[model samples]
Target: MPDQPFSLDQLRIVLIGTSHPGNIGAVARAMKNMGLADLALVAPRCEVQTSESISRASGADALLVGSSLHESLDDAVADATLVVGASARSRTLPWPMISPRQLGAALPAELSRPEARVALVFGREDAGLTNAELQRCHRHVHIPTNTEFSSLNLAAAVQVLSYECRLAWLDAGDTAPARQTAMAKGTAPAGEAPFGEAPFGVEWDNPPASHADLERYFAHLERVLVAIGFHDPERPRQLMARLRRLYLRARPDSLEISILRGILTAIEKHTGRR
Candidate 1:
């Protein structure tokens, strides 16, 4: 059969340190154009409810009015299962950066998970994201622009990424024709399945884990490691960072996260760290 329709509601567009109210409005308009409505603002320099924002938003003013504002990026992305930061600069330390197409392909599976939340983080127009801010993201997305002059306006970047996300959502839902064709060909026995094995099997014991859940796991893990003398918190040297990279790359679902947490708990009890 065909896949379920992608819900744009699962995706959140987050702006950090947005300087201009007009850009916020424009971003809202761009998101609405691509069937994305959820928006979150972090430490905005200007008021989102200003007349300028409403006027620039045109008919998409609802997005601006209903949008959420936060004091920090951490607060904004607290509940998100996946966080993707958009930037144009190269950092001293390499990050897992993916192109827009790769983001599109991976997002569909992520958003399909139970209670999944994804955040597309955008930074200021003039400076983009700071190194510290970029480090918080699981993946970084860069919109390839002209090398000679690759400065993209905040709204323009939002438009490009939003369009790509919409295309990916549509692609995920457009599997009916292929399924029909496969059935007609009789590729296998009559009762054979076509979609292949499901991730982590058919029965899931827990709802898909959120970003907050993973963070809690990491915090618990750090405590246990400290107690077990595995990680020295004072002079730590990228141990947690590397662990974050490994787990984030895997993008474990709810069941997998539970299993991992159970393993951690067992270790904690074994070492008398609990």
Candidate 2:
């Protein structure tokens, strides 16, 4: 099969509750630099298109003219196929939750699709997105940052995200093209399939896991497996592979994964396994 045709310009980045005209201008500049010109503003708290904003926009003034202004999120995302909410809080409401890097990895697939319109929604710098506002999204995201204080300025967030989008779409010329199956000559099966699907059906070798809580979950799992004789010192590695397969096959979603970890603890104590 032929590779899919991807166009980065199809992606749109939307901002909500933006408080500074200067930031709005900077965001326009950011989007332009990334080859993504579709920008939408939802109820900006500051005056837009001001001289300051235009000055910051530099040559990206065309984006300012093309940008849409709305009074609500519903209007802002009216035509979006994928909605990516940007925030530093994890527990926010939304669908398709992910981090900046996760979003970064998946954006190309979306932007590549014909007529696809992806939106990166940013909230106010003062309070970020409220739970209700985030719930409207198909997914939520948190930009990885200092745990002690995980906050980002509105314009800065736009800059970082747009930068990544630019690298994904425009950086194609900088490196050698990847040798996908279709790109290679002759008929041959790639060994990647096996590595892609471990013992179970873990489609992704390193599917997103809760890094903050995974260590503790793994420790509990190991302890229980040890008590149940599922994991023995002689062949602990083999047993772990099975457990890995189970998790992979299940493809436990973010919430389901959390529940599974909890169930593991209960099973350990109930069966006297750990």
Best by TM-score: 1
The TM-score values for the models, in the order shown, are 0.83, 0.61
Per-residue C-alpha lDDT of model 2 across residues 105-221, encoded as one tens digit per residue: 565444443544667889887888876566455556677778997677676788787777666555432322443432454333343332123211224423233322333455677
Over 189-251, each residue of candidate 1 has an lDDT whose tens digit, in order, gives: 344211112331223444555677777778888888898999998988878877877777666
Per-residue error at 204 for model 1, in Å? 7.4
Model 1 regions lying over 4 Å from their true place: 1-4, 180-208
Question: What's the lDDT of the predicted structure labeled candidate 2?
Answer: 0.65
Q: Each model's C-alpha lDDT? A: 0.81, 0.65
